[model samples]
Target: MIAVPRAQLRRPLLSSVLHILSVLFVFDLVFAVTSRSLFSACASLALVGLVAAVSNAKYESLREPFVFTDLSLFSQLFSHPRLYLPFLSVGKVVAIGAGIVLVIAGFIVERPVLPGSRALVWLAAVLPFALAFPVAARLPLTLDPYVDQCRNGFFAVFVAYLLNGLRPATFRRFREVVAAGPFATGKPIRCPDVILIQSESFFDARRLGDEVAPELFRRFDDARREAVWHGEITVPAWGANTMRTEFAVLTGTESFSLGYARFYPYAFVRNKIASLASWFGRCGYDTVAIHPYYADFFGRDRVFPLLGFARFLDIRHFASASRAGPYVADASVAEAIVAELEAADDDRPRFVFAMTMENHGPLHLEQVLPGESSSRHTLGEHASWRDLTAYLRHIENADAMIGRLLDHLRTSDRETVVCFYGDHVPALPHVFEKLGVNPQHSDYFIWRNYGADAPERRNLAAEELGAALLRVVQDHGNRAEQPHASEKAT
Candidate 1:
């Protein structure tokens, strides 16, 4: 069977021609170098199948098709197979492995097509690249990745998007959007140490069914009750791409405004714009970012400083922290936050933003705790019970971390604030599929240690979260300056 399915082939004649030519170009390039027509054909077909397989998997798990933005992660995908490979089935994994082996064998065993003619082989390889230039220059391009992929073939669409991304106009628009002023302005009467925890895969599990005990989110519940603001925030991403939501909240810029940069803002946007951290920095606060994972995963090590963070505490800082499962425990991250706050010798207010990793997905890989699959965690022995159970186990720790941070903030003599929010929903397609839950929203809350402001419940977009938190902080500052009833009477 042809790797390019008929469904994907339903396109205009122009698109079909472009797609065919693209495939032939790849085949020709390989055939010229390897001198094996059969292997070149197989390699081209394998490339087509791989793109389709990845696009389908992403759409299945992330509700979005593969776009050029995904190509940026191609290198990391190999380095971090555990994070992605689980989403692909065993059959698909084996097929991919076999395709790779076939290509390697072909390279070794097949005789060169143009043996003893190095110049001719080089010329043949260069011919395809030369031909692709004019063919690519006049091709129709669309920014809508999903529509483009469906209307045109995967190979053509990928090339189109790649070419579009390289255009100077794309960068100009991104810079225009980023040039806007900082997220928040005006210094507070007294700066309070602010701690924002972007928790991993945190959502109310009780939504799954009656079996998920309400107590699972008890600490979270308590925090909400006493919060200055709490609600469901619509995040940019669904199962993965935590940075999309992270960028929105930190920068107060909607993902939609980012164009192609929305998919991976950290890597795409070269210049730093106004972010919550940067705003706080100007307000005399010491800004720091903490993530208990590889700092370079999303280029955070390079981007964080640009975002106005004075210091970054990545996996290196948590080397001594205990692991709850595959990653560092959220509890240890909580401890690190507190330590960072208290370790300061001076009186400068600190703004510490942390991203938790304990609950990062591929939960099925880990066995559910002995009793995790019990009625308390799952309604019954359903197919997705194990994944749900493992999720709840980590969620329990995340809740504990919430409780710990709240406790620390509530007792601090200095005025303090804590913002807790989920980066995105967990990767639990099977669990959601079984329960008929359309996982879209993630929960968020901004709480203050000492304030008379009544608890306000309001739903907001991820981009608006930082501004909302800033409003609460500024309100607290304004109220602190007002004369008390007793002072006024005196």
Candidate 2:
């Protein structure tokens, strides 16, 4: 390792010191309010430790340091531990739990720091806030969370981003873009029902090794051959944070354009924006969103309406859906799509956007059950093979979901188009390391029924997906209105 100069380390060290002092001051405030030793000095340390533990785990999995926006997900830690907890080692979890217990026990036995007159106690409590204000105001920050996090520490960088996220200038560009309005897809003589599926943590796994089964993505390969457009797609997220990719594809907006709001775009959205749903709605199509998880997980329930979705189908709609491990199975989502189409009695075109939850990760939490095929013959008995095995099992269901939908669309008299893509690759860092592969992109395809197959491969950024689909739709419409030379002469 290269040695760093002492000068370079000074700022980071000072930042850590300030962060510790802030935590202590906050604990003192709590103790003053309670007028008991309920908030001990040890409790402050425990809180810092917990934040550090979570930050490290997230960094390892997602290649992103924890920021202020991540605080929005604290409730999810309790609501969905399986999704977030597995990233932390069991030892860290146990140690953090023990630390919290010890801190609480100290509250009962410890003595108060300011055991004096009520006026004096109140003065002691209020003094810290006054002192803290100067420190916070003087805190030098670059305001770039990823870089500032290293120089000014987690807490300071977190607060910096939080402050910046609230600034009006940060959203000025996005508001301007939204005001410009939706894409102008001219009036068409023919319109087909559109079904867009955002598959979770999906990538072509056969690229991992030659020992991998060729039949694994047979249905995916078949779809590619007949697709109007098919290829890899670069998304704005990794490991998790499905909404980043989701927002990009739906609105055709780059995440960076939102500034600090990019971390959780939905939370910042208060006005209607140009999006796939809004555009479709304007064209007289009934726009709907389907996801087998809580609609409010990422505030999608409130935000979907803003995006022009006429109906939002969430966990409530999938109460009886089949499960693959802990999530609603991909097959169940496919079934729901078909059910939605059949339920619509009117001849009005439909735009169904489904976000499938199967193949979501924390894959290491589950094991390969008995009789499951192993990739070890080629991968040679590594620890990560289990993750690969678990992934393959769930992916089989995803492939089956694709095949089933394609078959249904082919047989239906009503013309329909299916645009499918993965939000991001799975959180299988170890599996990727063992296989000597580091995938940076996920797969996508746009296929339509009632058309001759002329497959064209086109790779794109996540934001470009919506426009690309529209282009395909418009090309078909243009061709439909054209007359042959024989007809023109007549």
For candidate 2, write residues 293-343 as lDDT tens digits: 998788898899999899999999999989998899999999999988877
Cand. 1 Cα-lDDT: 0.79
Report clash pairs, candidate 2: none
Give each model's whole-structure lDDT: 0.79, 0.77
Predicted structure 1, TM vs. truth: 0.89
Error at 138, model 1, angstroms? 7.9
lDDT, candidate 2, equals: 0.77
On TM-score, the candidate that comes out on top is 1
Q: What TM-score would every model get versus the actual structure?
A: 0.89, 0.86
CA RMSD of all predictions: 3.8, 4.9
Q: List residue ranges in candidate 1 displaced over 4 A.
A: 1-9, 115-147, 181-186, 481-490
